[model samples]
Target: MNIPGELYFTKEHEWVRIEGDTGIVGITDYAQHSLGDVTFVELPKIGADVKQFQSLATIESVKAASDIFSPVSGKVAEANKKIEDDPALVNRSCYSEGWIAKIKMCEPSEKNNLMDAAAYKKFVERLEH
Candidate 1:
């Protein structure tokens, strides 16, 4: 539920921090809270291609395993190796150190499909209602 104002969010609950053409992706804080303790992260390879809304990685928590979809189509340029070794980073710092992948976007305009913090907050609110 910690939807920072700087990031964009997908309906799938993925968050993206866009820095120029590169975007850092992660599950929202709300997602990790719902998932409970994270135990494992299956990351995409550095050079792998992932399309918008496609499954890019998987995370296993105490409750269940979940696929993390790409927020935008792009080539994965890097992954957070720390999460593989200490998945709790996701629980502790979902928006920063716990980021899953860095992508070099194939279509920057896909950002338009994402929701800003206020919009996403309302979206989550609607889901609760």
Candidate 2:
């Protein structure tokens, strides 16, 4: 619901914030709402390599567990350790502190394939109908 203007989105419901050759990834607000109250998360370790549209992490909520997809191909540079300690942060702050991983983007051009906020906004609108 709160799709920030600066981020890109994937059909899998992941959001990406790009900065230079790095990207911060996380599930969108719509994803957290659909999942209900989050209980746990399995984040990929640093140095892990991830491919576009592939599984990068897993999130468990009261409703269900889901695999979080990578919006771009990259190597994991860092993960939000705080979320492992308190998964609720995802429900509370999905855009900022709740970001799951920071990747050293392997192909910066891949971002062009991802949906911009406006496009993603339209995509979610289509889903609601």
The most accurate candidate by TM-score is 2
- Candidate 2 lDDT tens digits, 3-46: 99999999989999999999999999999988999999999989
In model 2, the runs with Cα more than 4 Å from the true position are none
Worst 10 residues of 2 by lDDT: 104-113
Task: Tell me the lDDT of candidate 1.
Answer: 0.95
Q: How close is every model to the real structure, measured as TM-score? A: 0.97, 0.98
Tens-digit lDDT string for candidate 1 (34-124): 8999999999998999999999999999879999999999999999999998999999999999999999998989999999999999999
Q: What is the C-alpha RMSD of each candidate to the true structure, in Å?
A: 0.7, 0.6
Query: Which stretches of model 1 miss by more than 4 angstroms?
Result: none
TM-score (C-alpha) between model 1 and the true structure: 0.97
Q: Which whole-number lDDT from 0 to 100 does residue 37 have in model 1?
A: 99
